[model samples]
Target: MDKQIIISIGREYGSGGHEIGRKIAKLLDIPFYDRNLLDEIADAKNVDAKKLEKYDEAPSRMFLSRTVRGFSNSPSVNIAEMQFDLLREKAAAGESFVIVGRCSEDLFKEVKGLFSVFILGDYETKLDRVMERRSLSAKEAALAIERHDRNRKAYHNHFCNGKWGDSRNYDMCINSSRLGVDGTVEYLKDYVDRFIKTL
Candidate 1:
């Protein structure tokens, strides 16, 4: 059997990365994991999905007093371990999936038959998408976007300890905002096809 292509996506804030994944999933008729994934993991583990939502697709650390951060007990390691366990179990199930964020690319590094994708876009395009989706004023949107990006960076770094958006870490990187969601999805479908043939 052909090994499943597990598309793990890392994206810039407001890059429409999530929507692109959803569209791709629908087109391929496969499952896509995002926030809803937190729900599944939570239920299976008897953990509160709501509590995980605090870190959902967002970073656990965006900004903190250096002093406070220094004092944080290493308790986060427990949560990290649980999430990692969940990721491994899911990957072993061998289902086609489009999984977003949580440093999934790094998490699945040793897993055979996986493809990692990174999605990004120009600042202005990302900002526009954020504004439209959140219905926030310019000032509000700008602040929120920056915050979200930082949070993801901090979150991914916390576990992966590598640079985000580094091309080598992913199989393909797309500018979804430039492709305008649907275009990006179609592009990814084509991209995945070529990738599958090579394997």
Candidate 2:
């Protein structure tokens, strides 16, 4: 890619989006930011990283609209704004990177070469994948997936005021179950290459 490209990925609970984002970054020879973002935010704000993880993809009722409107600050909301600022700073500095989740689709909208993608899989596929990865039974996996997806949806809606996983919210929405992991990565690499060309 001749331009400074930043690929932002949003994903469902058990979708292979994280792996796909990592693979795309590897293929494109760029840095990958995911959980690492929490660490960076933690450092910048002088807060413990482990505490930030709970607030990572969660929309805290305490920190939502009313609190935001009143400026009744909470650590979680403060961290989120700080992280958004950090993302903006990184993009402004012309870094080529792939960021998974963290609502980058809306956060980096003004970025010149940013391409946002959403990844999802069928219910059964996601349940099976979560079961295998987390060593949980079918019922347990389904519950875990539900909890995660709900949290993510709430988080995205709170932050972006948009429907999570709606195709309209992203530059592309890929069904990871259809292509599997490696195939999804290949598809995204091609999609991103074409997107860069358009720039």
Q: Say which candidate scores most in lDDT.
A: 2
Clashing pairs in 1: none
Model 1: CA > 4 A from native: 45-47, 57-77
lDDT of 2 by residue, 70-185 (tens): 46456556667767778888888888899998789898887878899999999898998999999999999999998999988887887796688888888899899998999999
TM-score of each: 0.85, 0.92
If candidate 1 were superposed on the true structure by all CA atoms, what would the RMSD be? Answer: 3.8
TM-score of 2: 0.92
User: What C-alpha lDDT do the candidate models reach, one value each?
Assistant: 0.76, 0.85
Q: What's the alpha carbon RMSD for model 2?
A: 2.0
Ten residues in sequence with the least summed lDDT for candidate 2? 63-72
Highest-TM-score candidate: 2
Candidate 2 displacement at residue 3 in angstroms? 0.8
Instruction: Give per-candidate clash totals.
Output: 0, 0
Worst 10 residues of 1 by lDDT: 58-67
RMSD of every candidate to native, in Å, equals 3.8, 2.0
lDDT of 1 by residue, 1-199 (tens): 3567778889988888888888887787788887786687778879788877665544443244122543543334445556667777777887667788868899887766677888999888888878888898888888988898887877787778568888888878878766688888888889887787877
